[model samples]
Target: MVSQENGNQSQQTGGRFAVTLPLATLRGVGVQLGGRDILTDVTAQLRRREVTALIGLNGAGKTTLLRALLGEIPYSGEIRFDCVHGNRQQPGHIGYVPQRLRIEGNLPLTVFDLCGLSLRRWPWFLPLGTRFRERVYAMLDAVSVAHLLDTEIRVLSGGELQRVLLALALEPTPELLLLDEPAAGIDFHMQEEFYGLIGRLNRERGVTVLLVSHDLTMVSKSVGHVWCLKDGQIECEGSPHDLLHGDALARIFGSHQGVFGHRH
Candidate 1:
């Protein structure tokens, strides 16, 4: 675990991913779409500087919950973000990495252009200023994508693109980070590296993370806490060791022996 509070360090929260308190709280979260109930009374707390995984089978409303937290969808519940350290105002107070990024591969935009595209003040037609380009390069370097700075967006493979997206999400390092199926398209080795990077960020930078993934094996090993969502509601929650056995994980997928198989 990273250092939590050590005198003056606990008060500092800039240029780093330090979150020294419960950063997000959810209560009675419910969502309905097209008159069909998608989520019901979901409640959970995102601990500071810890990786928490949300696990469930496909169509279990995991993505819906993430969307609710992102404020992309309307929900009938309370989602609160507490002010961390001293000042809460800054660039990228919240960062998110979605499951898939759809971009035109043939677009001549280089990785450097993509990194600074969103942060640039002017429209896409304007040239990226020097300061902005340098900042983008720094962000890419954080995720080890600096070498691909001039590579076109379309040329990036599955793993490379994910790294770029992660670097973008962490530009300036947000206090709260959300990831949805971040390793969906990568192989096992790439997934390991990807998650390893996330763990390092959590431990070293103290960024609070909420991860939605189906990789039970990796999630079980990486996250400090597990929230099992089933049929749109959180069925159970605890440490990975506590919830990975018997019916705890089984029920999360609405199956007895199919999802986890003999692993459980």
Candidate 2:
């Protein structure tokens, strides 16, 4: 629950949190790694309940910025959260899904095991309670993954795995969600479903979402604001339609020419 008067003009919520300030404000955020500047002057305000997109070419510091916000990396910046999270650690108040998760294919981990472990604080030697298992199943049902409760994590398809991760994130719904390229391996159809699910959460549940994605068309269609990063600096910040036009697309992503208007 940290409040700062500085942010984009009128980046306030019109819903339940309207009386409160913006959900978050980042100002003069800079990061350096291995003697190289990863980000400089990266500032953005995330208004409550709006789905925002973070777009950039490879190595454009999108992940680095997310890491900075999560307090996973040491960086020079000021990241202030609204009063809802000011009293606690920011990481505990936010949910995150990375670009990809790597696990051994042969591991016998089940979906139930994964979710239960997160909610449980007891030693690994202790068995999980039945009541917790039921709760995990209920969350899985929300993401249409209840049928895969006993299935091995590695055995699930790409889209299924992503949804499972999403289900896990929504259980104790946080004030904000950080999704890093959540639709990486999913096909066209699955991607649509994934985007729709995110939209529903934001609109109905009032969760603020910021996702890193390369699907320009999907960003344009689903997100209210888009932040384009280049060389560790914010190259452009505006509505999806304004920043994702023809020449801007070509300038940022040369090989994916004319892809701004097409769906991935």
The top-ranked prediction according to lDDT is 2
Compute each candidate's TM-score over C-alphas. Answer: 0.84, 0.88
lDDT for 77 in candidate 2 is 70
lDDT of each: 0.76, 0.79
List the lowest-lDDT window of 10 residues for candidate 2.
1-10
Candidate 1 TM-score, true structure as reference = 0.84
- Clashes per candidate, residues 3 or more apart or on different chains: 0, 3
lDDT of 2 at 103: 80
**Whole-model lDDT, candidate 2?**
0.79
How many clashes (backbone atoms < 3 Å, residues ≥3 apart in a chain or on different chains) does model 2 have? 3
What is the lDDT for 85 in model 1? 33
lDDT of 2 by residue, 1-264 (tens): 112234434433443356235677787889999999999888667767889899887777988998887888887878877736572236567889887789888999999988877777789878888888899889999887899999999899989999999888786887889999898878899899899999999998889899998888889999988888776766667778777777666666675563333233
Candidate 2 error regions (>4 Å): 1-16, 87-89, 251-264
